[model samples]
Target: MDFPVLWCVLAFVAINMIGIYDVVHLKDLLPPLSMINAIAAAYLLDKYKLPNGLVALGIGVIFFPSMTAPIANLKILLGSAEPPIIYGKAPYVNPPEGDRKALGRWIKEHTSITDMVLVHSFGTQVQVYSERLSPTIYFNITQTPIAKARFYHDLRQNKPAMILIPMFPEYQNLVDADLRSFVSDLVKSNYHLESIMYNYQVFRINK
Candidate 1:
């Protein structure tokens, strides 16, 4: 065995010592032996048979996080790979959680006698707040800019009592010069800056 093979074996032994056995039940001895054998094969083949990238990838696969591993396994295991890059994995936020009542009073005080309608990006979750306020909410597509334009144009011509800006990613192109100016002028003159919610701006247009 070469230096790399010896190093991987040492790492594996260390992993077992550090309590990585909770993950995938390391006690049977077969998996560790299999891993050692793979490393040995990789070492011997590194010279003449196996490609360098393949050997390195094999080592990474053995050393990295197993998807089936228990949650705290990383704390106990050595050389654990970082969590994978999975798309659509939404980031988390921690809050005191849903035991407050002042927000109810705030919404009631703001939307009094106004037929408010909230516009948001689809699936951004403004609808939850709109329930008690009796305001309608419209949503735009997350991908196409053209869809956003059609939405903005519709909103301007209809002139809803209120508008909610969610600051979503897909609408940047639609928030161009004309759109910005129109919304800005409305906010300054007739629209009142109601409140901010989860990075969004709520504005009430006084008709």
Candidate 2:
């Protein structure tokens, strides 16, 4: 066996073992596996002197199952079928509609460009849509003690024009206990609730 092919097999096995213990998605494995498959196929063909028809049939049998989704997507692109409503990371689907979108638009229209916004427990969609800056680039600040301290310091120093907090069901459970308490107390003393969107609370800094 070729050294490069042997290395690829070993790497593939190692990655598979790691995946067994951790969350590894199929998409992450496709690239490396595809290269390995190609190299192995080339080696087999060179060694066996396989007939062209047999090689084509083998390739079709091996790859037909994986071609279904891509073919369907191609059909959709060619306007043969209506696209599905996919949420989260699908470029074809419409932008999500809800309190997040409303709040984003409100912030963009109401606040000045220079004003920073602090979003708690919610992702960076609001800041992205509003085209406003955030005190911290990270959306989740309660991951570690150091991260929490950095976020708190930045929050105090920046003094954002508004704070967005999720009010959806069980949203608070996602946040850290100490961080939640600190933010609640700070908001009560320094900020006031300006408006309540369907699933979010917007707080503006006190004058």
Off by over 4 Å in 1: 1-114, 119-123, 132-138, 141-146, 166-181, 197-199
Clashing pairs in 1: none
- What RMSD does model 1 have? 17.0
lDDT of 1 by residue, 151-187 (tens): 5666566665666554445345444556556556656
Deviation from native of the Cα of residue 35 in model 1, angstroms:
30
Per-model CA lDDT versus the true structure: 0.51, 0.69
Off by over 4 Å in 2: 1-99, 140-142
Q: For each predicted model, how many residue pairs clash, with residues at least 3 apart or on different chains?
A: 0, 0
Model 2 TM-score, all chains together = 0.56
Worst 10 residues of 2 by lDDT: 87-96
Count residue pairs with overlapping backbones in model 2: 0
